[model samples]
Target: MQWRGRRQSSNVEDRRGGGGMFGGSGRMGGPMRIPVRGAGGGLGITGIIILLIAAWIFGINPLELLSGGGSLGGGGGQTQSRTVDTKASDEMTQFVSTVLAETEDTWNGIFQAEGQTYKEPRMVLFSRQVQSACGTASSASGPFYCPNDQRVYLDTTFFQQLDQQFGASGDFAQAYVIAHEVGHHVQNLTGILPRFNQMRQSMSPEEANRMSVRVELQADCFAGVWAHFTDQKGLLESGDVEEALNAATQIGDDTLQKRSQGYVVPDSFNHGTSAQRRTWFQRGVQNGRLSDCDTFNNPV
Candidate 1:
């Protein structure tokens, strides 16, 4: 993806070693997991690793995946947190910081063009567990953005799992993950996330899940929007777009569910289907316009 020699963001909060509050007891979960409600949850390192191993050996089971915790969502979660002084992998840290800086550049330009001021969001790099405004999360919780705090929480080890377990690799794929979370931050700044959450509160579970799908798909499109700018700046290589599309396909709710289980349950999907994900992402990449990312008003 040609990310080397790029500017790194200074907003990164590194809490890797064992010096922070949750120090002694928090470094448990290894595989990333994002809770559905972004509330209280805990997965021992042994338990989460077992789940990941089971999925690796068996198949990527969505049911088993959500069984331990839940799907990713936003809200105020009970905060149980800690941090360490140890730095993260130097290479990974540099790569993420670069990505964040690039996104800031892209979004800043976009917002300015729209006659709005862009508020940059911070990214928090943590290891096993860290507390967020949404709640405390383990590595198993996966990477997520907490709108309440306007920060993106990430666990770098998840990149390994993305390659080895999810069959999604490449630097661009990793960037897509970061971009998608940052996309949520964009939504938060634009007041989309808060309004959507308000609407979700009055809907049925199925309805809320559908809304969640649109929200996530929009974030995917936002990632593509960022990709469009990167491509325009000649930063994208030949296969970079494909890497991101493959990642979007692999992480689709239906794809994950089918891999984990033998069948599909449409109702349980919080994220869009594989085709839908790829399509929405392509929409943004093709147009590079925010109007094209209206997953809620237009057909996804």
Candidate 2:
């Protein structure tokens, strides 16, 4: 992504290794689990050597593949986040910050050209748990933007999960995840999120989920908008856009449900189907016009 030595956004707050990430838990059935190794109990040295050899030979991730999946599972997960390796951690943080700075530049210029002020949203990096105006949440919720705080919260680990768990790998895919969450911030700036939240107050569960899907699709379009700016900057190589599109397709509510929970229900879909998600993102990319992102106006 040509991201080395790029300008890093000063808005990042690192909360890794902190304690008590859950101020209020139980959203989406507690913290989401990452695939990792289970206990390899009662294994002899020969067994261990054989396993390690198999891990290397078969391309298994020793972290989870041999032991079990990553965590035994974070419980009562009050912070105490794991510390990231300095070099590896800095690389991701820097990449995210640079991307954020780029978004600020893109949005600021676009807004100024229209005689408006663009508020650059802050991005927060945390671990297992973090508090927000919205409430306490685990990174299991993925990258989310809190409208009340006007900041985007990310657990860099989410990127690792994208490749290891979601089967969506690619720097651009990782970038798309960041861009999608930032898209929600953009929606907040446009008052789209709150309005929808308010409108959903009187809606039935089914209706609310439908509205949520529209909101998600709109965010996808916004990600496309970000891509549009990057495109102008010659930042994208061939298949870069495809990586993002594939990611969008891969993470749809339906797809995620099938992968994580198995099966799908149209009425329960809050993030639209894979096809719908990819389509809206493509709409934004192809048109590169904000007006083209009227996802609510169309019935998908």
Candidate 3:
């Protein structure tokens, strides 16, 4: 949580205040504003830094971001606008840069130790919705990683939402969110995502959702793996591990369902239960072994 004066990552593609290409970010509770990095004109930064800290960022469609629904309602055009305040804007940008630098250091070392190349994913900061190789997403969609471009898209205010709405506060919790996206990138590197997507071709919706659950849960585990190395390198502080576990518990598909939908549909859960999330995260924290995160072979 003590992040200040650290080197920020240069790979960040800031799109916070660009052309009026997107709309304001909205959620069930209320409308939220986020600090953005300016984008020249493209799907570079993340517009959806909040339905979650998972897979929603990149694969979501553009219409979904603008219209606030799947229909798109016929006015499907891109807009360009700028929305950013100087003071808050500065802080958010700095914080993300520092966090990204940490991720780069940890992941690079991890890949190096394995005799593999560590490709760092660019982090895009955007306001509202932005375009991506994956698709267009609204800030309401939450932070997500785009495997197609190898970048992480985030709406900075989601950090506020994580604390207020999801009850997952603290700096380490935020880092866990980013780490989870990075985890998806890790899965891509290992061919897990492509293989899983391939399996979805012949799968029933329920079965495919099950596979997606495994994929997401393993992402949680991979995030935990990052925490393990971070701790060893003195980047983790006291109570940091618990903060991550708290975050893992907060965003569990079951927990979110109960909070938002008033019921739990086990069949539709993609991110796993809170207990499952915590256990797998702890698995990587303890072992720090990539092999230990074999969620596919194990039962959910």
Each prediction's total of clashing residue pairs, residues at least 3 apart in sequence or on different chains, is 16, 20, 21
User: Runs in model 2 with CA error above 4 Å?
Assistant: 19-89
Q: For residues 172-254, could you state the per-residue lDDT of candidate 2 as single tens digits?
A: 88788778777776655544454455556677889977877777887888789888888888888888889888888778777
Among all candidates shown, the one with the greatest TM-score = 1
Q: How close to the true structure is residue 185 of candidate 3, measured as C-alpha lDDT?
A: 69
| Model 2 TM-score (2 dp) | 0.77
**How does candidate 3 fare on TM-score?**
0.76
lDDT, candidates in the order shown: 0.70, 0.66, 0.65
Deviating ranges (above 4 Å) for candidate 3: 19-89
lDDT of 1 by residue, 82-156 (tens): 332224448888899889999999988876664556778878888888777655667766788876667888889
Worst 10 residues of 1 by lDDT: 24-33
Evaluation by TM-score, superior candidate among 2 and 3: 2
Name the lDDT of candidate 1.
Answer: 0.70
